[model samples]
Target chain A: MRAQSEAHAPSRMVSETDELCQKIRRRKPSIYSELLRENILEVLKCSFPRFGTALAPGKLDEIASHFLSRHGAKRPQFHHIATEIVEFAHRGHELSKPLICLLEYEWILLSTEIDSARIQAPQLSGNTNWDTSKISLNPTAEIVATPFDITLVDIPVELDGTEQNYVYAVYRTVKHTVVTRSLSYVDYCLIDLIRREGEVAFNALVSAPPVQLTTDAIRQWVIEQSQNGLVICGTEC
Target chain B: MKENALGIGLRSELLEALCIQPAREDIDFLEIAPENWMGIGGRKRDQLDILADKYPLIAHGLSLSIADTVPLNVGFIRDVCSFLNDYGISIYSDHLSMCRDSSGYLYDLLPVPRRKENIEYLTGRICQVQDIVGRQLVLENISYYHRYEDQMPEAEFLAAIAEQSGCGLLLDINNVYVNSRNHLEDAVAMVRCLPSNAIVYYHVAGHLELEDGSLLDTHGTKVGEEVVRLGHEVWGWHGPRPLLLERDNQVPSLDELIREVGDVQKSIAAGDRYACSI
Candidate 1:
């Protein structure tokens, strides 16, 4: 009889647990409490692990609450949550550049992934022109120009204190793998020039600047970037 | 879907080990969470293409949030349906619990309140999803830490949902043991209460034991003896449905996972033989 009672206790306990939880749920604002906060925090930690590791104990929970208050019941977007975490770490922790770059790089991977799915790749047909000046960057290509090398974001070694301007381009390949290719300072500026001005004449892009890089060098860079599929060639007009 | 044939959850980390010592002949299929693959582009996607080409892929989604109050993300489901069609994936499984409420996704499965209203809600949603996909979806019993104020038993709720929705069951036996340990319910009784024929397959995985002696379904370790026994009992009762070994985190080497798969096959063989003798 005693064994039977002990054996039966678990079902009763389980029933009790359910009853208590149900009771708590019926009274108010729906199941909005520690669980919801933790849910948001867990998703962030799993998706953007570097920040989770960098954050001090209890800090994740704190940031999670901040996000929950803002996000309410809507599923927080990966990039949105990641951006918030980067800023949160910036205010709460040590120097901010590395963590920010880390989040940016990681979030770009996710963005490029989603971005690739939406790309319809309007086919160039009937009088297709492969002009460099007529081209545009692929939908998935994104450039990050930062003072600190974003590659060091994952590496634990200390920064050398020599923060040079660096350009990191995140792009999706034919095989769909996400990769980061670093570019020289000149290349970064030249790429930015085209993107900002939108389909400038070949000669216009190569010249007309304070940095005033040689036309030949700029032409060579354009050929190289164009070959690499970094920029779409302009249409035949 | 193969009767009594073993399956393993495909993990990227185990790819090298698999190449070195390919999975055994008894390992009939591979299971993957479609959410991880949808919108993914790169080496990982390439690897999946290769895997799908090589194996019979079954999609088990983690983010469907089928029971959530928000209207279904029809676009997301459409994306998944396309992926399944592209890969020739025949079955798609998701958890019985909700991953969201009116608010956004919780990122983990939450208990569904076991009430008639909620049952009707799941029935309507499941039927709606089936209509969109043109096939019945399988809902796995999730290992939950908290039981919502359910007016009914888990088994009864699941049975009703399946019967009304025309869905199947992916019985995760490890979840049975984990919930039993955590909540003090009888694992075998829970399994017995379910309509056995509805069990299309079974999920056996490892769990973490907390310091307080309760078990958590972490799927980060080796499947224990209790779970193995429970799986065997399932095979005996169901007369050899499919069994899948799932190791989500702390994945072991390929050899170790295969061995676990092999162990389950042997246990089921033994259990089925025993049942026949009786």
Candidate 2:
């Protein structure tokens, strides 16, 4: 009898819960606006995870307030919403450049993540032949420049950022993982050139860079890059 | 990937470990959020290609916002179908919630009302998505924080949608467990009431316990003992199916995850054995 009653306990809970839902339903009205508010809040929380803890006082509030106030009567995608929020944070809040730098870095990761997923593998143009000089940009890659060295946000505030910034590459790997790494100006030039020039020769790509390098050095760099999937060789392309 | 036990989501943090380590005997298959992998190139895409070569891929989309009251994104659906076909992935699922409507992208799954009007709307949308994808999508129950007064019970709503849309269910057992405690619903009864045939897979994940003792489905912590127990019950009730362990946050070391998979495998076996005896 005890065992049987214990088994029946959950069923009893079910009915009680159903009744509770019914009661709540009767008391409350629709959840359209409530859910809209909830979604806005949720988006703010997810996209800007550190607004409250990491950023300066009032920065988060200003962004949220501006977004909610303007977000009237219509819904917008979070990315567009995030951009406006960042802009609001910039204009409305008296934030330090470093702070803006930090926020931009954080937001870029999101935009990059969402943007890359939407890219379709470029129809290879049916080029099965590999040419040493011919190369193209990785459709799944992003190139960004930021000053804050958000790469090093933990260091003291004064040491965090500078007017001088560097370009960084965010690329997807075979594992479908997005990897972010800083790039030297020379390295950026080489890749950006490859992006601009569809398929080119090793000698031609090397010649375009202003910096003088031995043929051996250029060959070595391409060889190194090809290994990393940054620079493709004739057959692989 | 293990061929017959519980699986895990392929998160970015675990990519290197998955590539370096020997095939985890515990992972039956890997669940990829197509939103995370599709169209990405370079090492991540290269590595995913390798992983795909090694194991079967199942897509669980974070976007698609299926319940939104807006025109269907026919182009996006076509792209999704192309991605699935290119990867040779058969099973694609998304949360039975909305992320975007005409207003904008919510970026998170939000619950739809359990009203007849909303149900009819979702039925049409689900069918539209299935038609575009060229396969029926497996819709998962979401762990939502609040609910409005609805026309029917949650299970009935889910069943109705599954029946009307002709879609399958990707039952997230932890959602049932979390929602049960949060909303005062009965998780066990919720599982029992769901149409068993519609259930194509299961998801169990860890959740956070808030200061006030509320359970938040953060997927950042360890899977609680109760959820594992509930997994057994779900398996017994629904019979053998693909059960995925989603750990997006606070992911453990690969070795630890392998052990977790091993543990769930035992529960799956127990559920199967009990079903056989019955």
- The residue-by-residue lDDT of candidate 1 on A1-237, one tens digit each, is 000111111343334434433333332243335555655677678766775676558867776765544333342233344555555455554445665666666777666755534232333444443343454565578998666666664433345567776787787654455668798777677777777776666666756583576767766665667656566556436
Residue A27 error, candidate 1, Å: 18
In Å, what is the interface RMSD of model 2? 14.7
Candidate 2, B1-278: lDDT as tens digits: 23245678898788888887666655768889876666544456666877887768899987787776556566767878989999999999998886654444545676766766566667777877887788988999999876655446788889988988889999898899998988888888888989998988888788877788878888877667778778888877777777778887778887777677666657655743211110
Query: How much is B45 displaced in model 1, in angstroms?
Result: 0.9
TM-score of the first chain alone, every candidate: 0.61, 0.64
Give the Cα error of residue A131 in candidate 2, in Å.
Answer: 15
For residues B151-259, could you state the per-residue lDDT of candidate 1 as single tens digits? 6878888999888878999999999989888888898888888987788888888888878897877778877777877877776666677778998788877777877
Candidate with the greatest DockQ versus the true structure:
1
Score candidate 2 by TM-score against the native: 0.67
- Give the C-alpha lDDT of model 1: 0.68
lDDT of 2 by residue, A131-190 (tens): 444555555567778664557635234444345776887765434445577888778878
DockQ, every prediction: 0.16, 0.10
